[model samples]
Target: MRNKVTKAIFPVAGLGTRFLPATKSVPKEIMTLVDRPLVQYAIDEARAAGIKEFIFVTSRGKSALEDYFDEAPQLEQTLRKAGKTELLEILKSTNMDSGEIAYMRQHKALGLGHAVWCARRLVGNEPFAVMLPDDVIAAEKPCLQQMVEAYAETGGNMVAAMEVPSDKTNAYGILDIGEDMGAMVSVKGMVEKPKTGEAPSNLAVIGRYILHPNVLRNLNRIKAGAGGEIQLTDAIAAEIGTEKGVYGYRFRGQRFDCGSKAGFLQATVAFGLARDDLRDDLETYLHELLAARKAAE
Candidate 1:
C-alpha cells in the first residue's frame, strides 16, 4: 500500500491584496465566515481527513495566522471563572498541540507552486496533501476526506475537480479526461487557464490536491508559466500517462471560491444559513434586502 498521507501543506503565503486595506491588517485566512475564521474551517477539514501534521507556508505579516492556533490562556481563564464549559471547549478546540503545527516563510510571493515547495524538507519523500484555505467546502463529508478515501484505492496524485461553465475555463486548470470512472476521472492531461473556447474540458480543478513527492522535483524542470509565477498545474501536468498518473475526483460538496469578495460573502450567507442559531434571523434580513432592491428597481 502507498504511505499514509499524514502530512498536509497549507500554502497560505499569498498576500490578500484583492481585499485591499482590510487584508493589510488581517490575513485573509483569519477572516471569519460568521464566527469561526476561514483558517479554522480548513483546519477542521484537515482534522476530519486524518491529517496528523499541519505545515503552513506563510509570508511576512502573517503573524495573526500563526497566533490563531496558539492557546488563549486569558480567554480560557475567563470562561472557566464564568463556569462556561461549553464556551471554553469551543475555544480550546482551535488550539494546536506543541509539535502538531509547523511554519515556513515563503520569503517571496513566487506562486502557489513555490509556496508549497517551501515545505519540501518537512514533507520529505512521502505523498502529501495541499489545501487552500481560500476554498471552503461545505459537505456531509469534507472534500479532502473524500479525496483521501479515493486516494487509498487509486494510489496516485488526485485533485478535487468540478464542472464549470465552458466560458470560465480560462480562470482555472482544465482537465483532459481519459476515463469516466464513476466518482473519479482518469486525467489524461491538464491546461492551466487556457484561453476561451480553447480548453480541453469544462472540468476545472479546485484547491484540494494529493500529490506525489516527485511533483516537487518536477518543479525544477519548467520555468514560470502564467502570471510570471511558477504554476502548480504545470508540474502536475508533467505527470500525465506515467505509472502514477493523476485522477480527478468529483467531490460531493458545495465549494465556495473564497478567493474573491463575492465568493466570501456568498459563503458567509450559505454557512450562516446552515447554522440553527443564525438561520431564521439571517434569512429574514436576506429577504428584506431582496425586497428593497426589487422596490428600488
Candidate 2:
C-alpha cells in the first residue's frame, strides 16, 4: 500500500516585497481575505484533506505568521467570558495542536525548491504535500483534497493544473501533455515560465502538489532555473517517465493568485462576495462602483 499523504509543507518565507510597507511588518500569509488570514485558508484546506503534520518553511520576520497559529488564550478567555460561543469556536479552529505543526527557517531567499528541501528531514522518506499559500482555491471540495483523492489512484507526483490563455502562458509553469485523462493529465514534461507562444500546452501548474519523496531527492541536485531561483517544476519534471510518472490534476475550483496586488484585491472581492453576511451589500457596492466607473467613461 502507498503511504498516505498526511504531512504538508507550506512555503511562507517570502519577503512580501510586492505588498511593500504593510508586509514590511506583517507576514503576507497573515493578510486577511474576508475575515480569515490567507494562511488560514491554506491550513483549513490541508485539514480538510486529512493532513496531520503541518510543516512551515519560514524566515526571520515571519513570527506573526507563527503566532497566528499559536493559541490565543487571553482572546479565547475574553470570548468565553462574553458568552460569544460562535466566536470562540472560530478561534479554536486557528489553534494548532502542539506536535501537529513544525517550523523550519529557510534563512536565505532561495526558491520554492530550496524552501521545500528545508523540510526534508521532517518529511523523512514518506510522500508529502506542498501547498503554496498564495494560490487560494475556492472549491466545493478543497483543491488539495481533490488532488489527494486522485493521487491515491495514481501515486507519483501530482500538481494542481488549470488551463491558462496562450498570452498568459509565459507567466506560469506550462505542462507538456502526454495523455489527456479528462480530470487528470499524464505530464510529458514541465517547463517553468516558457516564453510566450512557445509553450507546449496551455495547461499551467498551480500551487497544490502531492509529491513523492524522490522529488525531494531530485531537489537536492537541482540548480537554479528561471529567474535565478531553484524552481520546483524542475525537480518534478525529472520524475516524468519514472516508474510512477507525474500527473497534472485539473482540480475543480476557482483559483486566485494572492501573491500579486491585483490578484489579492480580486480575491478580497471574491471572498467577500462568498460570505452570506457580506454578499448582498458587497454586491450592491460593487455594482455601484462599476456604474460610477462606466458613467465616468
Candidate 3:
C-alpha cells in the first residue's frame, strides 16, 4: 500500500530580490494576499490535502516566516480578554504544534532543487509534496488536494501542470506529454525552460510537486543543469522509463505567480475579488482608477 502523503516540504530560501526593498525586512512568503500571508495559503492547501508534517527549508533573515507560524501569545491573550472568539479561531490556525513543523536552513541560494535537497533527511523514505508558496492556487478544492486524489490511482511522481502559451514555454518547464486523460497527462519527458519553438508541448510544469523519495537519491549525484544550480526536473526525469515514471496533473485552478511584481499585483486583485468582504470596494476602486486613467489620457 502507498503510504499516505503526510509530509510536505516548503522551500522558502529564495532571496526575494524581485521585491527587494519590501523583502529586505519581510520574507516574501509573509507578504499578504488580501489579508493572509502567501505561506499561509500554501499551508492551508497542504492541510486540506491531509499533510501532517510541515517542513520548511529556509535561510538566514527568514525568522519572520518562522515566527509567523509560532504562537502570538500577547495577541491571543488580548483576543481572549476582549472576547473576540471569531478572531481567536482564525489566529489559532497559524499555530503549529511542537514537532508538527520543522525548519531547516539552506545556507546557499543554489536553486529550487538544492532547497528541496536540504529537506531530504526530514522527508526520509516516503512520497512527499513540495509547495512553492509563490504559486498560489485559488481553487474551491485546493490544488494539492486535487493532486493527492490523483496520486491515489497513479502512484508515481506527479507535478502540477497548466497550459502556457507556446511563446511563454521558455519561462516554464515544458511537459512532453504521452497520453492525455484530460485532467492527468502521462509525461514522457520534461525539459526545464526550453527555448521557444523547441518545447515538446505547451503544458508547462508549475511549482507544486508530489515526488517519490528516489528523487532525493538522484539529487545526491549533485549534477547541475539549467543555470548551474541543481534541477529537480532533471532528477525526476531520471526516473522516466523506470517503474513509477513522472506524470503531470493538469489541476483545475488559476495559478498566480506571486514571485513577480505583475503576478503579485494580479493575485492581489484576484484574491481581493474572491473575498465577499473586500469585493465591492476593490472593484469600485479599480473602476475609478481605470476611469481616471482614461480621463487623463
Top-scoring candidate (lDDT): 2
Candidate 1 residue lDDT tens string, 185-253: 999989999999999999999999999998998987768889999899989988888899999999999
Clashing pairs in 2: none
> Where does candidate 1 have its weakest 10-residue lDDT segment?
216-225
Q: Write the per-residue lDDT of candidate 3 for residues 136-177, one digit (tens) a residue.
A: 998889999999999999998999999999899999988899
lDDT of each: 0.94, 0.94, 0.93
TM-score against truth, every candidate: 0.98, 0.98, 0.98
- Quote model 1's TM-score: 0.98
Q: Measured by TM-score, how close is model 3 to the native structure?
A: 0.98
Q: Model 2 over residues 67-132: C-alpha lDDT tens digits?
A: 888999999999999999999999998999999999999988889999999999999999999999
Residue 135 lDDT in candidate 3 = 97
Give the residue spans of candidate 3 off by over 4 A. none
Flag regions of model 2 displaced more than 4 Å: none
